[model samples]
Target: MIEDPQGTILALFAAFCRVGGCFLVLPGFSSARIAMQVRLFLAVAISMAVLPIMWDTIYPKVSGPTSTYIGIIAIETVIGGVIGLITRYYVLGLQFAGTVLTMMIGFTGPPSQDILEDAAENQLTNLISLTGLTVLFMMDFHHVVMRALVDSYTAMPMGGTFSPQGALISLTDALSQTFTIMLSLASPFILYGLLFNVAVGLVNKLAPQLPIYFISLPFLITGGMFLLYFGISSLLEIFANGFVPVFEGR
Candidate 1:
């Protein structure tokens, strides 16, 4: 048997598709803070690390025509991308919660650059999202996501039939679950904001001369801050603890 360089290259590239595809959109790994070249190198390194374990499954598929090779790469990239998307959905959910928290606390500030992406965001949401993602990293979210990738191979075989319907269903399911989890995490703040706003509205009705919105702003913000100070710990703790399970359960 001849050792073929082309065959070897194809197999490696196919492996890279999955690993790199995931990291391309994976929370911390995909952060704009990290240089693109660095991310590329890191993805290559991780793909190499796992290539040995995945070689038997991947190499067999890439030993084909040039057109077939292109198809294989596309398929692998899509597979990896979907897995990454599901993982990312959870992180994004935290951002949604942060938006809710900001509205509830009435903590409006000038928009700032987001640490994760190239976008303008309020400071409170920015802080919550950054903190939540940081906590997820500390909790080894990469390991879990990677593990899920490995497991995904079993659920979806290498170079087998691709099911758009299945992928769509999975993505929809993830979105639904992520929203539910985020809402649950932000519920307390929602209730607080509702009651506080109602009271402010009542006061405004009683004294039309008073600048109720302005007068209540400090109290609203202060109460919110106090609630967050005491409850933030538990809120984040619960979110971090349940994230993996809730995501994996789906």
Candidate 2:
């Protein structure tokens, strides 16, 4: 039989606080589409699996006074939450880029249910977000998340003093880097939109009587769709490459 069952159990629970908090906002895993019960159980499973490895690091801080233990849990939760948010910001950047893409490409369809989230979104944006997330999953992004969480124990140990400034700095850097990468990925479309709109404007100026905008609507959308079809592979490829940079920023 295992000795000190109470200590072991407390350690497991402590580990859960961190892993659960992280996955709570994790991109695909945290989607509203995923049942809360599934998330809870998955978090518990991960905690149990990792607790043995993290026993030395986690068990000591968990054995203090009740108030101290509560504080430790709170601290660990924040650390985990911050780690998750870092990745979440990158995903949000992709969604934001997709939104911009839809507007630029003239795929401004009416709002529809987002397959990935509960919020309303353009269908094209939904398609792009879903595809990007799926590719990330296929690339084993969760493995990266789990590895990062494990390393976080060393970076921000349990019961350690939380630095609000450091957290803000890290969050700010993640956002900056994520959007930079996203803009790079979306640059081709942005340029296309610019050139296409400029041409449309010039044509409208040359023929004031013509309904240039209305005439160009179908062509604009059709051209953007064709560009999307051709460029999607490259767009997602560049995005997948950016995951390394995001983690490096962390």
Candidate 3:
């Protein structure tokens, strides 16, 4: 077998581009704070590590030295993106829960300083996103991402076609689950806000000029902080328990 060095280089380059592009958008791996050079190096390292294993199975099926290579690259990019998107969807759900709870506790709208995006945002959303990302890394939930990365090639191999309908359905399912979790986490704060609002309304009715509504803000904020402090452990535990089956496809 005459080893075509040009073909080998092209194949590696194509694989690198596809895989690297995917990681550029993947959560944990794709944070803006990381230097571009460092990320590129990491992506290159990943490609080097995995490509040899995949090339024998992947390269033979792919078309040779033409527009077909471009097509294959595009396909791989899509597959990698889908793998990253599924994980990101869940993280967004956790952030959404935090944002909702913050709003319920009267921390509504944008603030002057936002830690995550470097732009104005609801402080609570920013806090939640930061915390969630930190916790994700701390807990090594990134292993699921790595597993998904490996499984991606199995699920949608090189030169293998994508099932648009299946991908759409999967994305929709992930989003739905995210929304459900968000609501579940935020429910306590929502209930607190609702009950407190009603109570305040009743109290106002009994004494219109008592300044009860204005004075209640501090109490609401304080109560919300306490609830969050207490509920965080349970919320994270639920997230970990639920997360196991999600990537596992059980």
Give the lDDT of residue 214 in candidate 3. 69
Question: lDDT winner among the candidates?
Answer: 2
- TM-score of every candidate: 0.95, 0.97, 0.89
- lDDT values of the candidates? 0.85, 0.90, 0.74
lDDT tens digits, residues 18-133, model 3?
A: 67766867766777667779989988887777668778766675546577788888877877777677777787777778778887887665575655444566776777777777
Runs with alpha carbons beyond 4 Å of true place in candidate 1? none
Q: Write the per-residue lDDT of candidate 1 for residues 83-164, one digit (tens) a residue.
A: 8888789889989998889889899878899878999998888888889888988999889988877777778877787788
Please list the residue runs of candidate 2 whose C-alpha ends up more than 4 Å from where it truly belongs after superposition.
none
How does candidate 1 fare on TM-score? 0.95
Clashes of each: 0, 0, 0
**Ordering by lDDT:** 2, 1, 3
User: Compared to the true structure, candidate 2 yields what TM-score?
Assistant: 0.97
Give per-model CA RMSD. 1.6, 1.0, 2.4
